[model samples]
Target chain A: MEPIIIEGTPKTPTIKFDSSKGEFEIKGRSIPENSVEFYKPLVDWLDLYKESPLNKTVVNIRLEYFNTSSSKCILDVFKKLEAIHKAKNDVEVNWYYEEDDEDMLEAGEDYESIIRVPFKMIEIVE
Target chain B: MSFNVESYFSDISSGNPIHFYKGNIDSDLINKVLDTVEGKLIKGNEHSKLRKKVYNVLVESLQNLYHHVDKVPDDFEDQTSDKFGILEVIKEENGYRIITGNFVQADNVEKLEEKIKRINRSSHEEITELYKFILNHQRISSKGGGGLGLVDIARKTGNRLEYQFKKYNEESSFFYLNIFVSENY
Candidate 1:
């Protein structure tokens, strides 16, 4: 499948899904007015990828901030990844937060508790 | 309705306001608001935790204004009634305060008031449970939210949601919501 590469805007995050490289990343702020619509294609892509899986999939999520609506849409993204992980694929989520950002760290923990995948909390020194 | 530039400036100037605007809410506007707030927060001397928390709260608060702003009444005596709103970020000695105000239909104010009152009264534990429960059971509203922004703001602060509704004639009311992020937290 073709990869999804969306440039980041101030109100939306950049999404890069390289099927060939087995790496997916969502970086920057995600507070889109229409979050459900904004994330629909990315969610749809993961659904199609379920059929042909990579040996190891690393998903990097580094968001400076996201609104409540974006939070739900983000959960939808994680749910898709959970399915892949449950199918026995090597799926790992690298949840990055800036150093001393306790709120972001706890947000990652919230997803980790709900999803079965191993979440690595990576702290960026900024 | 005509905007009071004088009073708006006075309210913001009462404190060390970093950003203040009252106008349309769109992608560009949201981006500009967050950009200015984030840059200001990073340049300040607050702890990383407080800075990030305040930024997150500001994001949600501003988005609320964007999605939930009621259309200015047809008889609002203005031609530029495009879901306008107001936002102000003021600096305090101990923390930062975010003040956001928007127009809401008079009929919607009762329910909104009740929701905020419930959030203000909930303990931290109850709030966490309420937030989780809403995440699991609540359907996303047509407005692209699950009605969690205010609750999430309360949870992030671990305090009451300061809010008020001022009567704007009979058809609409101006809703004011405020959140404070303290350094000690």
Candidate 2:
């Protein structure tokens, strides 16, 4: 599968998924006009990647902020990864939050508590 | 019997007093407002994290207006048409004040009131725990059109939610919410 790269904006995040290296990254803001439209392709890519089953899949999320719709899409992404992890694939999610952003750190914890996949919360110093 | 167009234009355009866009609020307009606010913040050399918080709150508030407000006209093309919401960022002595106002139906006021009260009553740590608890146990309820959005706003602001409601009619209310993130604070 070809890699997907999206530009980031004040209201949208950049999505870079490398199918070969199994490194998926979503960064910046995420308040897209239509969350479903912005995330559909990325979700589809994840679905396709699940079939090939990379030795290790690392999903990195460094979102400064996102809207409620984006939150739902993030949950969907995690649920998809959890499914892949359950199938005995190497899947891991590294959720990075700013050192002082306790809110984002808690959000990571929220996702961790719900999903069955391995989620590591890392604090990035700015 | 003549209209004073020049005077009206002069009064509206003078000094850039944080103009309010009142008619239909759409994604394009919202993006414009977000850009304006962000530009001002960056020009002022404000903290990057606080700017992010303000931007997030702006989007969530506008989305609430777009999806839930009932005053929107049927033919309004913009996502936030007739939504009757305001997003204003005023330069204060310290930093800036971000304000958003919209309308809420009467039936949904009680739930909103309860949620805000609960959030305002809790400490930051408690609110964090509550956010996780809700995320885990409570399925996103489609009631009021913005289930977790409000919670996310409260969480981002890091302060007790401040709100006021004015009786618009027998069945609806005007909701006003204000959040302040001081550059020094």
Candidate 3:
């Protein structure tokens, strides 16, 4: 599958999904006016990747902030990864947060508690 | 009390007022506003993390107005502008405060009051629990929000939400929501 590289906008995030390398990452703000519309392609891309996912899939989520709608869409993204992880594939989600951003840290924890995939939290220093 | 436009603006713009818009709002206009606010924050040299919180709160607050804005009662002059709302983002000495006001049916106020009051009454730990519970078992509304915006705002700022309402007529009222985020938090 061809890689998906979407540059970040002020209201959206940057999604760099390299299916060949089984590397997926999302960064920056994600508060799109219509999150479902913005996230549809990525969701479909993950659905395609399930058939021939790389030996180990690593997802790096380094978002500064996302609104309520984006939060649900993000959880949907995780569910996709979980589907692959359940099929005996090696999957790891690297959740990064700023050192002082307790909210981001806890947001990661919330997702961790809900999703079954292994989450590696990385704290970025101020 | 009659709704005085000047007093409403003055009350919400207590701090160093940065931007205020009052009129019909939609997704297109909201994206434009978000862009302008992001530029202002970036130019102000706010720390990256702090900037994110302010921007996030602004997104939720403004979007709330966009999705659920009700007619300001047909009797209030022109009907075209009845779908209007007010937004004021001010920079405080310590951080920033976001104030948004929009008209809604008088009947909805009761449910909103109960919801916000419940949120305001919780401690940090309790809020965390409620946030998780809601997020995990989310029944997303038509607005695409799972009712997590208010909880997220409280969690991010560690501050209670301040709000008030003024009746516009027999059918509608203006709802004002105040949220402040401290840099320390």
Candidate 4:
């Protein structure tokens, strides 16, 4: 599969999904007014990735701030990963937050509770 | 008391006003407002956590206005505008206050009020649970969010969502939302 790489913007996150390395990462702010439009391609790409199995997939999410709309889209992305996880593939999610950002930490926890994939909460020091 | 847009905007725009906008709201304006506010937050040397919190809530608040703001009343001064609204960012001693105002059809007032009241009544943990539940169950509408913007704002600020509905006319009313983000929080 051709890797999907989208550069970050002031309002959107950087997306890097390389199937060759089984590596996926989303970093930066995601406060787009139309989050569905911004995230639709990623969700589509994930659906395609699910077809060709990667033995192990590691996903990292490091968002500074995402609006509520983006939050829902993020969940959609995770739900797709959850499908792959349940299909007997190894999937791990690394959720990163700033040390003082308790809201972000709790956000990660919220996702951890909802999704079936294992999540590791990593704190970045200010 | 009846709500008057002119008085409300004048009252809130005073007292160390940072940014105040009264006009139509669209995607492009949202991006500009966020960029302008982010620049001011950085220039002020606000703490990272506080800055992020304020920015986050502002994003939700503005987007809420974008998604939900009603058309200006036909007789209203800004009749030419669509999705007309007012936004003010003020500098307070302990924190920043973000105030947004927009007209809503009188018919929709009760529903919107009940939603905010329900959110205000929820404890932090309960709100978190509610957010997760909605995230999982609710489908995203064409308007974009799954009714999660206000809930997310309350969850982030840990404060009651202050709001008022002023009677604009028999057909519609103006809604004002005040959100405060404290430096110490």
Candidate 5:
């Protein structure tokens, strides 16, 4: 699949999903004006990815902040991953947070506890 | 009933330290407010980190107002009545202060207070875990009543939640929440 790239703003994050490298990275802030509209394509792509199936899928999330609607969309993305995992494909989510950012790290753990996929919480020095 | 519209505008637009918006809540107004805040924030040379925090807080607070504020039909007989809340941002000595106020039924205040307290008490790790748990297990409430918004705000601020409540009338009270994100902190 063609890579998905979105520019990040103070209010939004940059999303880079490279299908060829099997790497999906979401970075920056995510407070879009319309969460549903902004996230529609990413969700759609994930749905398609599930059908074709990859040997291994890695999702990297390094979001500094996201609004509630964006939070919901993130959940939707994780749910899709869970579905893919249920189908017996290798999938992992690497959640990155600033070293002092306890909230982001806790958020990663929260997502990890709920989904069956392996979630790695990494602290990066900013 | 007579309405003191002039006084209302004066109270909001006067040379008060805080810039306040008071009136009907809608998406258009929310965006407008964000634009105004963005202009001021960037002027202070806040760069990307401060700007992102301010933007996220603005969105969450406005969403709270839009979803929780009591509303009556536009054509209601009491045209003077206002249904929405107020949002204010002030420049403080150390950093920016964001404040939101709205009227809520008395019954709902306790739940909200409890949620804020829980967020304040939670460790960074706990907050992260809580966010994920809510994502997987909590169903989004109809009419946007869920606590996910508050969770997002708390996570973004990375500071203790500050709030107060004042009785507005017999059946309801005005809830005020103030969050401070210091430039140096």
Candidate 6:
């Protein structure tokens, strides 16, 4: 499958998903007005990726700030990955938050609670 | 409509007006508002946490206005009726206040008021639970609103949602929301 590589903007995140390498990353701020429109393609790609099996799938989320709309969409993205993990595949989520950002940390924890995937809360020191 | 729109605008126009806008609210305007406000917060040397909190809440507030604002009264002047709304950022001694004004259909007022009151009355833990429940169960609306914006705003600010509804006419009313971003937490 072809990789999904999109650059980040002030209102969106950088998305780099490589199926061959089994690594996916989303970084930066996500406060788009229409989050569903922005995230629809990625969610669709994940659906397709779930069809093929990978030895291990690693996902990284490094978001400084995301609006409530983006928050819901982010959860949707995680739910898709959770399905992949539940299918007996090796899926790991690395959630990165800045040091002293309790909100972002809690956000990661929120997803961890809802999704059935293991999450590593990595704190980035500024 | 007993609500004096002119006086309300004049009343909030006081204080250190960091930024004020009254017109059509589109995606472009939302980006500009976020950029300008984030720049001001950075220049003011606000703590990163507080800055992010304010940015997060502000994004929700502005997007709410963009999606929920109703049409302007036909007789009303200054016709920017396409998603017409008012936004004011004031610098108080204690913290920054983000005030947004928009028109709402009279029929929808009761539901919206009850929603705000419920949020204002919920404890932090309760709000968190409510947020989680909705995130897990609620379907995203056609407008891309998951009914989580208000709840998320309250959770982030740790403050009650202050609001007012001024009767504009039998068909519509002016709704104002005052959200404070304090340095205390």
Q: What CA root-mean-square deviation does each model show from the true structure?
A: 2.7, 5.7, 2.2, 1.8, 5.0, 1.6
**lDDT (Cα atoms) of all candidates against the true structure:** 0.83, 0.72, 0.86, 0.89, 0.74, 0.88
Judge candidate 6 at residue B37 and give its lDDT.
93
TM-score for the second chain in candidate 1? 0.91
- List model 5 lDDT by residue over B1-185, tens digit each: 23222233333342234468877777678768888888878887875566667677778888888777754334333345355677888776666677787777878888889988999999866876676677667755666534577777777777787887766555666677778766654
Candidate 3 achieves a global lDDT of 0.86
Question: lDDT score, residue B19, model 2?
Answer: 35
**Which candidate leads in DockQ?**
4
lDDT of 2 by residue, A61-122 (tens): 99888777777778878888888899898999999999877668877888898899999899
Q: What DockQ, on C-alphas, does every prediction get? A: 0.62, 0.42, 0.64, 0.81, 0.42, 0.80
Residue B138 in candidate 2, Cα distance off native in Å: 5.7
Model 5's CAPRI class is acceptable
Proportion of true contacts reproduced by candidate 1: 0.75
Better of 2 and 5 by lDDT: 5
Residue-level lDDT of model 3, residues A1-126, one tens digit each, is 899999998779999999888899999989875788899899999999998898899999999878888888899899999999999999999999989777788889999999999999999986
The best candidate by lDDT is 4
Residue B83 shift from truth in candidate 6, angstroms: 0.2
lDDT of 6 at B179: 89
Error of 2 at A83 (Å): 1.5
Clashing pairs in 6: none
What is the alpha-carbon RMSD of candidate 1 to the true structure?
2.7
Q: Chain B, candidate 4: TM? A: 0.94
Candidate 5 segments exceeding 4 Å error? A1-29, A32-45, A58-65, A92-126, B1-18, B72-83, B121-125
lDDT by residue (tens digit), candidate 2, B33-73: 87887787788786776666766777777777776665622
Give the winner by DockQ: 4 or 6. 4
